[model samples]
Target: MAETLRIALAQINPHVGDIRGNAERIRRARAEAARLGADLLVTPEFSIGGYPPEDLVLKPSFNADAAAAIEALAAETADGGPGVVLGGPWVAEGKRHNGLFVLDGGKIIARRAKHELPNYGVFDEKRVFEPGPAPGPVAFRGFRLGLMICEDWWFPTVSETLAESGAEVLISINGSPFEVGKAQLRIDLAVPRVVETGLGFVFLGQVCGQDELVFEGASFVLNPDRSLAVQMPLFEEAITLTEWTRRDGRLVCTPQKLAPIPSAEEQVYRAMMLGLRDYVNKNRFPGVVLGLSGGIDSAISAAVAADALGPDRVRAVMMPSPYTSRESLEDAAACAELLGIRYETIGIGPAMEAFGAMLAPAFGNRAPDITEENIQSRARGLTLMALSNKFGDMVLTTGNKSEMSVGYATLYGDMCGGYSVLKDIYKTLVFRLCRWRNAHVPAGSLGPAGPVMPERVITKPPSAELKPDQTDQDTLPPYEVLDAILEGLVEGERGVEALVAEGHDRATVLRVWRMLDRAEYKRRQAPPGVKIGPRAFGRDRRYPITNGYTNLIA
Candidate 1:
């Protein structure tokens, strides 16, 4: 008969570069696991030094501090608590490597390095850490347990090697970031490994927002038969204990409570909220303020800011210029009232006139064109920045992906902000997210209930309101068509002709492709925002601003 083994999974949020602080967190979790009578505790990959430390791993001091923190945790385990399987940076054989530290009996019994270093997409692990050889199972408490870091379990080789080395169960830790529909992909990818090895699999993940990445801790356990035994919640830190018992010469994990995963809309909304909240809080911003233009983009951005940092912390400024309509003013006011945030009506007409007068001398009788329109936008930006400076709040920009892709935004004007809430969100998704928020206020939302967004905002034609009777369609295609074309180009990286062959107009595709190519410089200067898609502008899609590549011309 095999004795029952209790394992505690710690889904914790680790701050990057906070070695001692992360060690403190591990200590607290270890104490809780000991109180729960668990035999072992597992943490996510890069738990101590945080995930994707990037170039920080190059510093000798950072690595030294990380090693010291590991030693501290190992010494603390001397008091007879649960054994810890933690992850951090390790230096071995004159090369820095991402490693898993197996600590028991006041010492690191075994050290396993990450066998696979993912280099595609947002990961650049190959540049920083050296990959270790294929790791075999580590013997622990009368069981041969295989410990696999993130990217290791994604392939069949690691699990096969472990099973061949007499491993009974697989424990995989991850610092997996949240993208749209990423949760399902994790399960889909892990299930095949379980089927191939005929071994129970336990997935432990870290939960928190780091820069543009959000680590959703949807941890789970799958038995050898491919049945889900335990599930941890997403977008939260948790410690779940699962009991494994031997039945009929096979180790079986007992079923535990499962948390309901949020809908696609809810997941994206929460990811934005979490990403914004952490960015503001971690960077020590007093709060956030944005221009409330009563359009869907600004309205939803205001709502997200209110929900992220309570309404009191959010501030809205309505900067109405000469071209600003009465409906926009009414809807902007209504939106502010619904969210219960500080709202101010600052007419940008005065600033616009001042700028017009100042630039009149250089105009040399030239007729008013985009220069005048951009002045209105710059006026609003200047006002928002002034308010941000006075009130000590960060400015939140509210441009959607559709506008961003086609170079429809004013660079130094509307793009002036500390952060962007809807940077990666498409215009179509913006409408959907706004409707979802109105219908269902997310859990832990700080704004008032029942349709925080005014209905008129969504139904109205989207506009910058920089000129009289102007709408986005005056210069761009319908959002439905525009978003689809942009997605095919941006996400799929399809050629202009490919998009045209997909039933889109060749002229429209060529025009959009030209705009997208020309907007690289603007995007390069734009603020960082939450990334919900795989091919977000910054980090993920790195196109040179000076490049002359053009799919349309080709």
Candidate 2:
């Protein structure tokens, strides 16, 4: 008996709250599967409401919309064609669940809720919805299948039960967002489940970018011995089918090796590029514009913008004040020229002087301090805002994570941008990225040849050029110390006492904590950007704006 099961993986991307579009996407995938003579097809987790719908899942209207869409998708298989397993929101007994709908013969055959809802590190599944009970096996065409949702596949008890119940294969539908090295880890994690259960395993994934997260779509099928049978490409969408022949009353497959994965920097850069491009293109922005200082942060951001939107679409303005050095001008010009993007220099000295003159009388009693220095930054911000208004271009904010953490950034000044592309990257990582860009231009770097970031920009003392002799280290701790403390305090959620107990100076730890806490208001006001770290200073980690409890500076 020559019997082969043709299963298709629909590596499609879905937008949050766009249920109709997502449902249409699933329909198209089903149609393709039927045409290709596929017996089954699966989409990634939350493909209907989109992965990480975040707070939108709370809205009753959105939930209702998702339910209706799910019914529509289920009704799609009415012709007894290729069966479909797709992600969508399903609520039962007044409780919401991150669910996968298994549709067959024009009706929903079975529903599986994600049991292991991740709560830590960029996940808040606990706050939003209750976890569902462990899933059982799904019967399909003379086979008992062990089906797991995105997070459920991480564990064994649920899948093991399905295997014990005589499951021929294990299938995992995932909306698993791609981080720096998550793809390899996901593959490694899937292998154990496959080998242990002695069953063929398939992982169907979503592709493209949504907000800060990017789905790599590295879908793969694994043999019973924990080896790859087939694999898909990264960061691209495709519908692929794997043929499995049943032998000895169990599914059998051949194993193959996946290609080499990209480096961390390469992954990060590509994610940002895809994220920025999709955000701009999907939102219908004509082009992107940014303020380019001679600093490495702006240099890197501009390069990314150029690479993402193309040099012709990336316009950069060098807004220099009196504090801005000639060397800065030279470097900024060089970097922009290297990228071959449109560059314009706008002098903010006159406007800054005007603002200073206007505020002189009001500030006569107070000593000239950060307030006045901030006036310069605001002046530059106003200029950029005016330019953005005059020409329809989205301004890219160049603030990095370190500055965002400690209120080192100026509000409405450098923060005046539609998106913060590198807001999640730390200062230490910024240096590494500059070096990385020089060594190898990833997908987002504008130039193919040499260093886009000037050596002086990377090697020079970090400065805001706010005053004549202002350096970042003059006010804040070294980047290594700062990043370590931030990781402990923010991501690790360690208290100040615990941080100090871990070989950290109490005073230094306290100082960093205080700075981070006080800067909460500024981060709250900042624009949304791509989140790289586990707990980015965005919706992932929410703290009160009004709080006097400082960890250090009393």
Pick out the ten consecutive residues of candidate 2 with the lowest summed lDDT. Answer: 442-451
Residue pairs in steric clash, candidate 1?
A: none
Runs in model 1 deviating more than 4 A are 247-250
Provide the overall lDDT of each model, using Cα atoms, as 2-decimal numbers.
Answer: 0.89, 0.82
Q: Residue by residue across 1-554, what tens digits does model 2's lDDT show? A: 44577788899878777888888888898888888898898888898888888888899999899888888777867887899888877889999999888888778899988889998766888898878887788887766778888888788876787788888888988878776777878889988787778888888888767776767788888887676788887766788877778877668764545645777887777777877877787677888888889889999898788777888888888988778888889999998888888999998888877887898887788777898788878887787778778988888889999889889989988888888789888888888888887788674344446667678989988889988978889999988999899888887889888888788888888888888888999998898787665677775788999986654322
Off by over 4 Å in 2: 1-3, 31-37, 58-81, 92-95, 126-131, 443-451, 493-507, 546-554
Winning candidate number (TM-score): 1
